[model samples]
Target: MLYLFQQILNGLHMSALYALLAFGYALTNGVVRRTNLAYGALFAFSGQTMILVAVFGWHVLWLTLPATVALGILAAFAYAALVGAILARSVFARLAIRTPNAIVVATHGVALMLMEIGRIASETRDFWLPPLLAWPVVFASQGDFRATLTVMQLINVGAILLVLISATIALERSRFGQRWRAVCDDPKAAAMCGVDVPAVFRHAVLAGGLAAALAGILTALHFGNVSFGTGLVFGLKILFVTAVGGYDSPPRAAAGAAIFGMAETLWSGYFPIEWRDAAVFLGLVALLVLRPGHEETRVAQP
Candidate 1:
């Protein structure tokens, strides 16, 4: 019983992480109204940039917490922005209106290109952040055992929640939110109503790219590292998770992602760890086949 509660507590962090990344997916899909395959690669690019920054010892040269974090942010977001901008101008701009399949294929190519670039740039080296806040904070103790989480984990959870809240509020009150909702609902209608549909999509793609970068840096900070190869796999996980909750609604996507994170954690805790991913993914696949929010999640016609 104690262990189960501990597991739940542990799952909270992972659940928040899922919400963060899925938020990025929701942002992109909300505006483009189509699946953009480049997102996972953008995440990997951010992670790889962080690895390179650490490799270069820039963090040590900065000599301050804010400066160090700023360096990391610069590296992560710069690469993400550059690649995202390229995708927006070169690929999505030219292909999205005419050949959606081409957009998919082209984005896949871009993803592969980013992965290869990351692999080559890092020289296939592995780097992780030094254990910054490794102290465990005990929340509950059962006799001789204490359920604990690191201070960094708590901080990460808090930071992620703050970001989620701020973004949610901005979405409700900001012009981008209104335009995003309009475009997602009906692109032609939005264009007819004087919304620059293309611009909205580009902005959404950029915003989503940055969101993925933020998630990458945060996850790297928490876990100390990221796999360059996780781009597509992570993106797909976000996709399945959001699909369950309705990708058309960012709130729903976040909720669904949080649920998946909890379920995944619990499954690993109580069942065969090796089968955890298989079981979760298969379950999601079954749910996806059902696709509960089909009408809400349908892609808007270009």
Candidate 2:
């Protein structure tokens, strides 16, 4: 029972990390039809950037979290603008003539370029990230029933929950959220109704990027390690969460993340950690088979 409880707590922490990544990816997919594979690069960039900042001095470590998030938002905005502009000038301008496959290939090429850039940026740096907090919270009636959580883990979980709740409420009740919904429903029609489709896309990308950045930083903080390849693992996990939960709803994605997190943690604790990914993959397959077309409709906007 104690072991089970510990596993649950660990799962909660993992779920929070997955939720952050899934939310960002879902938002981008919901708003724009394009999948920004370059997003994984942004996650790597945030971790590497935080580590670099910390190396300068321990005093600067305090700023790593916020600075990483800011950089993520800025990078996302810049990347979105550049990608959107390029597509507008090149591929999108030829939409009438270009095949869907061609556009996908082009975007994939862009993703590869960004990935290579991230790899180059952190090639020489150490992959370890210093711990953001020293103490862990302990709760136990007896030594055998003990459960421990680090300060950073608690902060990460809190941050993710806060973002998820705030985003859902804002999307359903806020004015900007209404415009976001309008653009998501139909960009051309929204434009006809005077919605700024381009601006909305930029905002979505920026928000998503910031969320991804925060997730990456928090993960590194919790685990005390990060590397260029870290983004690949995280991005794939996020994709799984999004697919399993139905990419159209933020809450659903978060729920899916929580489920996956619990499954992975428990499986890792009882079995081999190597089996964790396989367990998640199997769960995803089972969910898909069981919930056919569950995500057919987008969540209604407030």
Candidate 3:
């Protein structure tokens, strides 16, 4: 029973992390109409950065929270402006004029380039980030049936909740949010009404990048380690959550993240860790098979 409880808590923590990444990915995809395979690289980059910073004996490790998020936002903005622009000018523009396959190939090519770059930069270092907090909360009591919660985990949950709430409020009440909604609703109409569609997209990409970077930092703090390939699985998981959750809704993405997190956690605990990928993939397959064409619904305004 205690083992079960521990597993459950672990699952919740994992789910929250995945939800954060999913939310970021969904936000960008919702606005840009393009999927970012490089999204996960932000996590890997932030984690690696955090680890390196910590190793330098800098007191700034304590400031990783905000710094990591800022890094994420900056990286996202740069990647979107640079890579996204190149795609827009070279491949996407050609595709718009000729064949849609150009867009697909271009985006995939960008993803490949990003992955290779990350691999080369990260190498095979098993980097570690010092824990953000000490002490773990015990949530259950039984013969070895204990569930422990870390301060970092709690912070992660709080951070995600805050992001979701803030995003919701901004979208519902702010002018920029309104403009974003308008752009999403009808880009042509929004542009006609003087909304800057490109600016809106840039902001969206920035938000997504920041979110991914934050998630990576938090994940590093939580797990105490980072690797170049870490973002690969994370990217896939975000894609899964976005697909399962209504891709347009942040709340739904969170929900899907929780579900996926819990499933992966529990399965990993009970079965071989190697099966984690297979389990997650199976779950995604089940969801898709059960709800074919569900994502076709129009995105709801905040």
Candidate 4:
């Protein structure tokens, strides 16, 4: 019973990370009608940037937790925005002259380039953040039954979920969301109706950037280690989440993420931990076999 409860707590924490990042990818895919593979790169970049900031803070500035964390968040956000702008201008905007497949391949190339850049920046060294909390905090207890999680983990999970939910509500109920929906339905028609099609695309990327930034920072803070390779693993996992959930619905995508996260946590807990990635891969294959189709057709029309 205790073990079962522990697994549930673990699953929720992992699910929060997956759901937030998947939400960002779903937003971009819904708008452009194409999977932005470079998003994975953006995720890695933000986390790596945070680690770099931490290293500098520790070695040079002698800053404490509050200062270092703030600096990391700021740097991650800035870097994500810059990367999003570049992707919008260089890859997405230019798709007018090429086939959609071209952009798909281009996005993969962009992801590789970003990973290479991260490798170079870090000089092939593993980067880490100072531990956010020294010990786990128990949330529930009853003589011999207890549930515990790190304070940092709890904070990161709660804060990211809150932000994602708030953003979703605002997007669904506000004027900006109305315009975004207009653009997504038919960019040409939206433009004809006085909607700024290109601007909406840019905003979508920027919003995705912010989501990626928050996910990156929170994940790194929770784990205390932000390896350059994490982005690839996370990227693949989220791709599966987006594919399974359907890009048109952020809420559904988040739901898919939770399922994946729980499955993974349970598998790792009961079996060989090293085989968890393979399990995820197998799960993705099975999901695709059961429901295979083009992602663009699934976007919700408003």
RMSD (Cα, Å) for all candidates, in order, is 2.2, 4.7, 4.6, 2.6
lDDT string, candidate 3, 197-232, tens digits: 766766766677677767766777778776767777
Position 162, candidate 2: lDDT: 92
Model 1 vs. true fold: TM? 0.92
Candidate 1 ranges beyond 4 A from true positions: 58-69, 296-302
For model 4, which pairs clash? Answer: none
Q: Model 3 shows how many backbone clashes?
A: 1
Models 1 onward score TM values of 0.92, 0.81, 0.80, 0.92
The lDDT, on a scale of 0 to 1, for candidate 1 is 0.80
Candidate 1 — worst ten consecutive residues by lDDT sum? 293-302
Query: 1-302, model 4: which lDDT tens digit per residue?
Result: 77778888989899888889888887777677776778877888888888888778767898987787788778888888888887777777777335655667888898888888889988999877767775888877879878898888889888978987897897899877887777767777777888887788878877887788788888778877677777888888898888888777777888898889888998877899998899788988788779957544422121
Tens-digit lDDT track of model 1 for 19-74? 98889789887755566777887887797687577656554574455456567778
User: Model 4: which ten-residue window has the lowest total lDDT?
Assistant: 293-302
Candidates 3 and 4, the one with greater TM-score: 4
lDDT of 3: 0.68
Q: Provide the overall lDDT of each model, using Cα atoms, as 2-decimal numbers.
A: 0.80, 0.67, 0.68, 0.80
TM-score (C-alpha) between model 3 and the true structure: 0.80
Deviating ranges (above 4 Å) for candidate 3 = 57-104, 143-145, 292-302
lDDT of 2 at 203: 70
Model 4's TM-score against the true structure:
0.92
After the best TM-score superposition of candidate 4, give how far the Cα of residue 64 lies from its true spot, in angstroms: 2.8
